[model samples]
Target chain A: MSKKIVIVGGGPAGTIVANLLTKKLKKEEASVTVIDKTGRHVYEPGLLYVTLSDQDPKGIVKDEKDILNKKVRLIVDEATKIDTKRKMVEMKSGNRFDYDYLIIATGARLCPEEVPGLKEAAYHFYTVDEALKLKDALEKFDKGKIVIGVGGVPYKCPPAPAEIACFLDYKLRKRKTRDKVEIHYLSPLPRIFPIESVDPIVNKIFEKEGIKYTTFFNVESVDPKRKEVHSLEGETIGYDLLILIPPHRGSKVIEDSGLGDRGGWVPTDRYTLKVKGYDDVYAIGDATDLPISKSGAAAHYEAKVVANNIASEIKGIESRDKYNGKVVCLCDAGNKAIYMIILQSPLVPDGSIVC
Target chain B: MSEEPKVDRLIDARNTFCPGPLMELIRAIKEAKVGEVIGVLSSDTGSKRDIPLWTSKAGHKLIGIYEKAGYAEIVVQKIK
Candidate 1:
C-alpha cells in the first residue's frame, strides 16, 4: 500500500512541507494531504504593514489553491481532534483521515476576547480581517491618543508591535496629523526588543519618533464603553483608537489532543521536530513550543527540518538534520529596515545580533 | 549560432533570516538570464515556500525542491 502522509494546517509550515513532499516523492509512492480551516492563506508577517496601511492588504493574501502544488490534496476543514492511538484525525466536517505519518502545523490563534471588553474597544491586526478592520478604524480617527498594547509574551512576531508603532507614526505624519495624534506603546517586558542588543537601537528609534514607551505595565482589562484600557499598575490609558496585540496560543486541536505543554504548544524534540511521545507525529511552525519567536520565518525553518527527518524515516535513512534554533527577523524602522539575528545555539543571553 | 547561456546560480542563504535571504533570492533571480536556473539553499524555513511562490507568480518554474541537513534547496528555472 502507498504511504499516507496527513498534514494538519495550511499555514506557512503545512503548505511548505506539502509542496516539498510533492516535489520529492512520486504521486504513486506517497500521498500528501493538507488540512486547513480556511482557504485564505495570509502572509502573516505582512500584517504589520497592513495594519498601518503601508501595504495593500490584498497583496498579503492568496488563495490556498494558488499556493498548493498539484500533487498535494488540500482539505478545507478544522481538525477537531487527533487520535494518535487510531492514527486518524477527526475534522469538524465529520471527516476522519487516517495517516501513516502526521505533521501538525496548526498555527497560533489570538484571543482578544479573553480580555474583558478588548474585542469591542480595541483593534487587532493579527489576521487579514483584523488588519482591514483596524485600517478602517485608524483612517476614520483623525486626531486622538492611539495606544498599541501587547497583551502577553510569546506572541507571534516579537517586533511587530514596535513596527506598528513606527508605521503609525509615519502614517500620521504623512496625513499632517502627527501633532494631533499621540501614540503610546505598552509592553509587558522592560525593553522594546526582548534581546538586549537590539533594545538600545529600538529605544533610539522610539525616542526619535516621539513614541511614548511604557514597560512593565501588564494590561488588566479593557472597558469598551469608556474607551479605556486599565493596566495592572493602576493606570488607565484612554484612546480614540486602540491597536492591540493579544495573547496567542497553539491550535485548539493540539490542546484537545492532550499533546501540548502547559502553554498550549506542542512538545517536540528541539532538534528533530518530532513530538515527544510519538515518533511518527511531528510538529513545526507556531504550533511547537520552540524557544524561537512565533513567526512565519521560524515556521518555515522548522518545516525544513521536519520534512527532512520525515523523509529520512520513510526511506529508513539515518536523519542527522537538527534545528539550530536560529531566527532572523526584519523590523521596519520607518525610513530604514533593521535586521536582527538570534543565534540560540550557544545559549547566549537572548540570542540577539542587530544589523 | 551557439546556444544562449543557461544561467545557473546557487544562492546559499543558509543561516540567514527573513527578508534578508528572500530579498537576496529575488534580486539574484532578477539579474539572471532567461531560461537559467537559480538554486536557493536556505535554512530559514520561510524561504522554502516564499521563493517558490515568488517564482511561480513572477512566471518562473519551480523545477525541484528538497531538504538536506536542516536546509531546503529550492531551484527555480527562469522561464520568463
Candidate 2:
C-alpha cells in the first residue's frame, strides 16, 4: 500500500515539496497531493517590479497546475479543516483527503481592514490587483508628500517598504519631479530595518536618496478625511499619497482549524519544521512562527529540509537534515544596484553584497 | 604557507542562483564520509560568502576557497 502524503496550500513551499516528493519517492512508495484554494499561482517577487515598472502582469501569473509536476495531484479547493486525530483534511467542497503525513504551507494573509480606514484610504501592492491599482495611482501623482507607512509588524517582505521608497524616488527623478515631492518611510521598529547590520547600509542609501524615515511609528489608524496617518504614540504624519503596508496574519484556515496561535501563525519547530506537539504534521514558509523574515527564499530553503526528511522517513532511512533558518534575498535599490542579504539566523545577516 | 588540500569529491553547481550552490554542497556533505574533502563550484557570488559561513557553522573544516575564472571552487572537509 502506498503512503498518502497531502500538502495544504500550493504556494511556493508546498509546490516545491510536492514536486520534490515525486523525485524522491517511487510510485509504489507514496502518492502526493496538493490542495490549493485557487488554481492560480502568482510570482510574488515580481509584484515589486510590476508596481514599480510597466511590467506586464501576464508574466507574473501562472496556473498552479502548470507549475506542479505531473505526478502530483492538485485539488483546486479550499481546505476547511484538518482533523489531526483522524489524519484527514476536509475541504470546503465537501471533499476529504486521508493522509499518513500532512504538510501545511498555507502562507500569510494581508488584513488591510484590521487598521481603521486603511482598506478604503491606503494603497498597497501585496497582491496582483493591489499592485496594478497602486501603479495607476503612482502615474497620476506629480508633486505631493508621499508617505510609505507600515501598519504593523510581521508583514510580508521586510525590505519591500524600503525598496518602494527608493523606486518611487527614482521614478520621480526620472520624471523631473524629484525636488517637488517629499518621500518618507515609516517603520514600527526603532531602526530603518529589523536587521541591525543591514540598517546602516539602508540608512546610507536613504540619506543619499533624500528619503526621510520615521522609526517607532506603529500605525494605529488612517485618517482619510484629514489625509494623515495616526501612530500609537499619538504622532501624526500627513500624506498626499499613502502607501500603507498592511498587517498580515496566517491563513484563516489555520485559525478556523484551531492549529494556530492568536496571531494565526502555527507553532513550528525551528529545526525540524514540525508543528509543535504533532509529529506527523509539518508547517513551512510564512505559516510557521520562526521569528525569521517571511520571504520566498526562506520558504525555498525550508522546503528542501522538509522534503529530505520526509523522504527519508518514508523510505525507512534515518535522515538528520534540519532547517538552519537560512534566507537569501536580493533587494532592488532602484539605483542600478542590488543588495544581497544572507542570514544563518534571525535578525543577523551572515553576509551582504552591494552590486 | 599551507599547501592546497586535495579534492576528494567535486559538486559542480555553476550557473545556479543563490541557495542553489549552497544546497548542493549541503546535500553532498550529508552523503560524504568523515575526513573526505568535498568541493563545490559555484558561479553565484553570494555562495562565495555563504558557503564558508555555512561550513564553519556546520562544524566542518574549510580547506580553502579557490577562485577560478567566472566561478569559485569552495572546498570543505566533512568532520562529523
Candidate 3:
C-alpha cells in the first residue's frame, strides 16, 4: 500500500512539499493531501506592496486548488486536533484523514489583542484588510508624528518593521510632506535590526533619510484616547499615527492539540526538522520554533528538505537529506533599490550577507 | 546478499551533516566511470536514507546498503 502524506496549512511550506511529492512519487506510491482553513493562498510578501498600493491585492491571491498539484487532495477545512497515536487529523467539519507522515506548516497568527488597546489604535499590514485600511489611512493623512515599531518579537518577516519604516518615509517624501511628518522607528530589541550585520546598514539609511529610531522600547500598552504608547521601560511616546507590527503566535490547532510550546511554536529538531518526541511528524515555516526569520525564504528552503526526505521514505529509500537552514531574503530599501541577504546557516556565522 | 559489492571509490562522510554526504556521493559518482561502483560511509542518519533515493533519481543503480559499527555504507553503481 502507498504511504499517506498529509500536510496541514496551505502556505508556501505546505504547497511546496505537496507539489514536490507529486513529482517525486507516482500516484500509486503515496497520496499527498493538504488541509487549510482557507481555500485561498495569499502571497504574504505582497502584503507589503499592498499596504503602499504598489500592487493590486487581487494579483497576489489565488485559489488553493489552482496552485496545488492536481494529484494532491485539497481540503479546505480547519484542523482542530492531531491524534498522534492514531496518526489522524480531525477537522472542524467532523472530517478526518489518516497519514503515514504528517507535516505542519500552519504559519503564525497575529494577536493584536495581546496588548491592551493595541487592536483599537495601531495600524498594521499583516493581512489584506489591515493593509487596505492602512492604505486608506495613509492616503487621507497629510502630516503627523508617525510612530512605527513592533509590538513584540518572533513575528513573521522579521525585517518587515524596518522595511515598513523605510517605505513610510519614502511615501511621505513622495507626498512632499517629509518635513512635516515625524517618522520614529521603534523596536523591542537592543538593536534596530535583529541581524547585527544588517543593522548598521539600516542605521545608515535611516540617518540619511532623516528617520528617528529607538531600541529597547518594549510595548506595555497603548492609550488610544490619549494618543500615546507606553513602553515597559516607563517611557511614554505620543503618536498622531501608529503603525505597530502585532505580536504573533502559532496556529490555534498547535495550542489546542498541545503539540507546541508556550508561544505555540513546535519544538523541532534543528537539523532534521522533525517535531520533538514524534518520529513521523515534521514542522516547517513559522510553525517551528527555530530561531530563524519566519520569511518565505526560510519556509521554501525548509520545505525542500522535508519534501525530499519524505519522498525518499515513501519510495523505500532512507534518504539522509537534512535541512541546512538556508534562507534567501530580499529587502526593499525603497527608492526602487533593494538588497538581498542569503543566510546559508543562521546558527553559524558564514559571512553570507554583503552590504 | 552477504557478499559486499566491489567499489571503485569510497567517500567517508562520517560526522558530516546531511546534504554533505549526499553531495559528496553525487560528486564522486560524476568523477567515476560509467560502470564503477561507489560507496559512501555516512554517520548522518538521514544520509543513509537520502543517498539511495538520490542514486535512483540520478538513474544510477543502488547496489546495497550495509550497516557498519556507527555508520551506514551505501553502495551505488553508475549506470549511465
Real contacts retained, model 2: 0.00
Per-residue CA lDDT of model 3 for B1-80, tens digit only, reads 58998888776655532124565565456456889998988665666666676565557899999998877899999887
Interface Cα RMSD of candidate 2? 15.7
Candidate 2 residue spans exceeding 4 A from truth:
A337-355, B1-80
User: How much is B75 displaced in model 1, in angstroms?
Assistant: 49
Residue-level lDDT of model 1, residues A184-223, one tens digit each, is: 9986554565544467777887898899977645576888
Question: lDDT for every model?
Answer: 0.75, 0.82, 0.81
List runs of model 3 lying over 4 Å from the truth: A336-344, A348-355, B1-80
Q: What TM-score does the predicted chain A of each candidate obtain versus native chain A?
A: 0.92, 0.96, 0.96
Off by over 4 Å in 1: A336-354, B1-80
Ranking by TM-score: 3, 2, 1
Estimate the TM-score for candidate 1: 0.77
Candidate 3, residues A240-321: lDDT per residue as tens digits? 9999988788999999999986678888987789999988999999898776667778899888888888888777786668
Q: Give the TM-score of candidate 2.
A: 0.79
